[model samples]
Target: MTATKLKPTLGTLHLWGLAVGLVISGEYFGWSYGWGTAGTLGFLVSTLLVAVMYTCFIFSYTELTTAIPHAGGPFAYSLRAFGPTGATVAGLATLIEFVFAPPAIAMAIGAYLNVQFPSLSPNVAAVGAYFVFMALNILGVSIAATFELVVTVLAVLELLVFMGVVAPGFSFSRFALGGWAGSDTFSPAAISGIFAAIPFAIWFFLAIEGAAMAAEEAKDPKRTIPRAYIAGILTLVVLALGVMMFAGGVGDWRALSNINDPLPQAMKTVVGDNSAWMHMLVWIGLFGLVASFHGIILGYSRQFFALARAGFLPPALAKLSRFQTPHRAIIAGGVVGIAAVLSDGAVNLQGMGLTAAMITMSVFGAIVMYIMSMLSLFKLRRSEPQLERTYRAPGYPLIPGIALALALVCLVAMVWFNPTITVIFVVLMVLGAVFSKLVRGRGAIDPQLATEV
Candidate 1:
């Protein structure tokens, strides 16, 4: 049977929405967890370092996305630069990043909702969210993207409202009262906390690169993709800084640092617990989680479909539905996410809580993808100088070099600080390699289709 292709229907707006929506949830929750690891001051330093890495990474990654313009994102770039093995590794890492992230976000969503409705169980709510969003995704890409755009716009506005509400209470003195959180100045413990905070700091901008995965379905990807990526990253940087500063400044950062729903908790300090603003935050904040949860589902589906179409995964996963959506891939990813949520009890390695542990694993995947994609960018520039390119990364070698170096540092920090998750990541990589080899050995992939895009 012939493979069905994703419909090209997305414009720059949809791309922007998806890009922002895929990561907007970070503004609401995960990054605050960094405060628990490194305290306010230490996490701030970590955030600054991570911000630099992502800025450089996005600029460099844009060139690859525009030049290649495939749905595989990093996988496509690595496939062109380093062949199938590289593609497999990149694809698996992308899967780990995209697939694992939603469950964590879903848990946050449940926690936010449960605060509003004391009767609701977080796990049940999380599972329900998966089903609802997965169904929305299978409807059609345009419809799904339109939903993404709407919810993302609302989510962005809510964050601004949050900043405004909390701004009146913002106090530099309060923010710094326990900012260092007992970590000695320049001591080994302080140094270790900063490194350990790297993953949570990365939570601020983890999946912004997922924008490139929609290239195949985006209108004029060369122009649209680059613009969306640049615009999206800038928007996120502003929001991340705004939310972090205001949230910590308004009240005790320590109180909300380890919670799944930090924004609502932080807002509670400025507006009393019973205030309308607090209620608004809990209810409206759910949209932020939905935006990312839905958008990432769109992203991982495309990544799965691309890898399958390229012969790296089972051919069935590349199959499209009557609506021209990657229904199989979407369902497959949903299954994995649901399984992660259900197995939360078993997967809470290192006592970081399920959400934190999952975030660590996702960050681990992201670092690998970043390192490989940057290497692929360098390889492609050296090996295919004459290839067509509409846009080149502004800083070229310097930007990509900086990104690569930082990604390596983050990887080292992640392994050193979170050994349990690191071991799990290694096992996942090995399993992926074995599965890829077995599938290829069976001649299950169509060579013609593999090279089509």
Candidate 2:
């Protein structure tokens, strides 16, 4: 079967919008959960460290993205460098990262809407969000990307507005009050808290790499992908710091530490629950969640399309609509996300809320992808020195080396702190491997197509 090609409608700006839009929701929720585990200061330390890791990782990852320029992202690079097994692992990890994130974002959207309409159940609203965004995605890639750009701009502006509204009430004393809630300075427990906080810190920049998944759809990808990746990371770092400082400093950080709508809750300290700003925040905050929810659905559809097109997943998922979008893949992914939402609502396993558990699982997948992608970069550099390249990772050995070390640290920390989710991730990987082997036995995958861009 011939591979289905994605429409090259996305430019650097669209890529930037998708990159930032894919992660802007992090500013609104999830990161605060770190405060619960590590306190304000410990989480801050973790965030800074994770931020550095992302900066280095993005710089290094872009080299593969630009050179390969495939919709599969890390999967394509790993396949080229490592082979079928490596591609399966990389593809499965990509699935975990992209597939698991939407349910969490959907839950956040539900939570945000619930703040306004107390009558609406969060689960119902979350399911509703999945339907709306998935349909929008099926319409077309250009339409979906344009929508991502618009909502992303609105989301960024809203965060700035939030900071401006809460600027007067920002108290350094309040921020420092719980900076070391559960641990002493440099104590073992403090150190543990910092490590335990890694996943949430990762939450701050998670899925920005999903921008690379749009490579096949990007115009002049070699030039456009790098520009988008660089600009996106810089924008996120600034927003992450600004939101963290201002929100934690507004009042008792503990009050909003684990809440879904931390921004509005923080604003409530200054504006009161009924204030116009609070109402505006509750409404506008949904845009942030929508931006990510919609963008990630876009990301995952392409991932599913890539995997299916390569025969790693069922070929039906590779089918494109008349609009030249992966409509089937979008719908398939939505089904999985909806199932996740319903399952979490029913079980509430590990005593962690649906959003938190999903985030943990997603971060686990991201760490695995990071490790594999960096290794692929190192392997390809040595073996394929003569391959055509429009861009090269700056700091070469040093930058990717730092990214690999940090990713290893994060993986170990995750296993130590989130044993259950780690186990789940491992099981998922094993199952994916089994399935891949079965598919391979049937002679489903085209070896040449699997490794080529």
* Per-residue lDDT over 1-453 for candidate 1, one digit per residue giving the tens place of the 0 to 100 score: 675677789999999999999999999999988898888888888999999999999999999999998999899899889988898889899999999999999999999989988899999999999999999999998999999999999999999999999999999888777666354658777778899899999999989999898898899999999889999999999999999999999888889888898888888888899999999988888899999999999999999999888777888988998888999999999999999899877765887888998899999999999999999999999999997889998877999999999999999999999888888899999998899778777777777766655
lDDT of 1 at 316: 90
Worst 10 residues of 1 by lDDT: 176-185
lDDT for 416 (candidate 1): 95
TM-score: model 2 vs. ground truth: 0.98
Q: Which ten contiguous residues of candidate 2 have the minimum total lDDT?
A: 443-452
Across 70-101, the per-residue lDDT of candidate 2 in tens digits comes to 99999999999998889889999989999999
Candidate 1 pairs with clashing backbones: none
Error in Å for residue 405 of model 1? 0.8
TM-score of each: 0.98, 0.98
Return the lDDT, model 2, position 288: 90
The C-alpha RMSD in Å for every predicted model, in order, reads 1.1, 1.2
Q: Give the poorly placed runs of model 1, Cα more than 4 Å off.
A: none
